[model samples]
Target: MAAMKKKSVKKKSVNKKTASKSPCKQKLSVSISHDHKLGHDPLAWLSGEEIQSLSKINDTVDPMTFKETKIENEKIHVPGIEAEKNIDQPVALEEMTKDIDDVKASETGSLPGDEDKTQRTNEDDDMLILPEIFGIAQAEDMHGELSSLLAVSGDIEIDASTIETLDASALQLLIAFIKECKSSGRNVIWKKSSAKIDSAASLLNIGTLLEL
Candidate 1:
């Protein structure tokens, strides 16, 4: 019995020693940076020229030298009154304005029918005779003539007896003129229109508007 008890105590001590040794013998974990490839360092990729360029990026600058240069300026001599005679004189504003007015007169001619406007005194008949050909070519003259009549401030008669060719534009101008006459409270008398004028007025369907 004594030998069996001593054997059991030795077995328990062996188990306790084994447990303590197992805790102390546990493997210790080590950490390593894996940012780069296995055996290559990032700085090892740079060549000697590249390292030299990087080193030069922070190198000190050399002292600068500046040389002074003296420039000789040539003096210019200008002629006084003699130079003024050689230069062309500028045109006066009044002359330039006159030239512009002359151009305008040449382009558009004297206002409408002033060239052919019948000059009549108070004793003459108060009638404006239409030209033989009443078309776009004559509308401007007719307008000017009618406007002049309006300025006269009196009841007027329009002689339409000789309108050989009456166009739509001319008819429109006559209709507008008649309207203007009526609005100004002025009387307008039509001295017997030609057959062309009557046909043109009917074709445009403005006979009623013109009070024809």
Candidate 2:
């Protein structure tokens, strides 16, 4: 019986040791603080003036307005960039050639026209009444009439008082006709002049060319 009691005590002691050696399970918890208490400012490292400047910048720079301003600046800059690109072409050569042609035409007294003034006639002097609206639309008909008239003899009378809407194309045709007349030694008299013709000629810097 004593031996059985000692064995029961030993079993109890082993049970206590096994219980102490077993792993323990525990739960952990984490907490986050979001309160901005006094003397705990996130921007505490920044100076007062720096903070004020930053606030001013934030107030002045609106996201939408800044985006709009950037767009407007791009709009303005794009045209200038395109203009610069266009100006980089060989325009100087074309302009120089045109100037040389004009100078030669002026010096020779045989200005550039549609046709060479070779056809001559001994018919009586003619009078032509210009149409009211002389523009690009009427250029073809006017050119035909002027070419036919170039063959007429004596002084040609041109009544320009009826012209109302005269454009560059009409002015060009008239210039060609006048140059043809001058080269052929035929006189061209402007019986009546219109303000539109004079203004257009002056605007195009072809007043001398048209003998306005």
Candidate 3:
């Protein structure tokens, strides 16, 4: 009976020790829920006023146009020029258009007052200038004038500035005279012409042929 009692006591002690060890070796767990307070809000790093100020600041971007991209007084290099630079934008459209028109007029020989200046009589240049009214009314006088001009050893110059009209006969006579001058190796300059000459030549469709 004593030995059975001692065995029972030993078993009870072992059971108590096992119960203590089970409580000590229990697993630890952490849980979070919507009701849980995190002490401070995560957005507390930015103040309420700071967040509002940032939202008020406009961060939206705007699109750009071609004219806006070009800087004022910017220059562009042109080819085949003497390192000349042209402005990127035209200062005045009227001025630019006027300059372009002037260039075109010069190329087409149509600039205002250019004909008078170009065909002006050079009295000091020793060129043989014809009489002003080379009219068919005095066709014999014109013939005599031509004979005298051909008698000279130099080139001939015709001053047609005072002529107001040109008849068919006069036109034919002028053509024959020019042809004869060319055949004789004489340089004939039809200098100092008026608008009347050009008008008459154009009416006959012989402006280019007569070099009016």
Candidate 4:
């Protein structure tokens, strides 16, 4: 009985040591808060290079990490914050590329209604109406409505009072249109939430936009 008790005590100590030495042991603590945007149409927001870079990063960033952590929770906080670090990639490159494209488009007088193969219109020649405000700032409004429409059905009208008319079908169609346009490299105007896009749609020179 004495020998058995000694062996039992030894086994308990070994188990405790093994538990304490678990590979999952973490010592340091740091975190960051992010108001994450999920289900983003990455193609719309990311340049070809950025997309490629992200894909490489994704390949390297263990897929399990993404599954385990929500996008907002994945933000890393480095210790010893002597200075605040900004986004790694500068906005300049994307802005420059967009400017160059706009210049080239101007030189060629590219109309808003330009057709690309991936566009969602049933007709081959359907064109998007380009708005005056340029840059990524406009994209927020555009993607928000686009995302909302995709989420549920409501009265989906391109009218001045359209949101009230949106239904599930309309939202689905709108999402499809946005995706198609994005995939086709078509220019888009993300309207502001309170911007009365339906009114703008009415104001748009539809006659002039239509290609005869």
RMSD of 4: 22.0
Candidate 3 clash figure, as a count: 0
Candidate 2 lDDT, tens digit per residue, 16-39?
A: 344357623211111111121121
TM-score of every candidate: 0.42, 0.41, 0.37, 0.18
Which tens-of-lDDT digit does each residue in 143-208 have in candidate 3?
A: 644544454444667778777655776777777777776777767777787787788887889775
Q: After TM-score superposition, what is the CA distance of residue 49 in candidate 1 from its true location, in Å?
A: 99
Per-residue lDDT of candidate 4, residues 37-105 (tens digit) = 122234532343333232332122222233422123233335466236443442454445555445533
* Model 4 lowest lDDT segment of ten: 1-10
Q: Report the candidate with higher lDDT, 1 versus 4.
A: 1
- Which candidate leads in lDDT? 2
- RMSD in order of candidates: 44.6, 39.9, 44.7, 22.0
Candidate 4 error regions (>4 Å) = 1-162, 192-212
Clashing pairs in 3: none
Between prediction 1 and prediction 3, the one with superior TM-score is: 1
Taking all chains together, the TM-score of candidate 1 against the true structure is 0.42
Where model 3 places Cα greater than 4 Å from the true spot, the runs are 1-134
Order the numbered candidates by TM-score, best leading.
Answer: 1, 2, 3, 4
Clashing pairs in model 1?
A: none
lDDT of 2: 0.55
User: Which regions of candidate 2 are displaced past 4 Å?
Assistant: 1-125
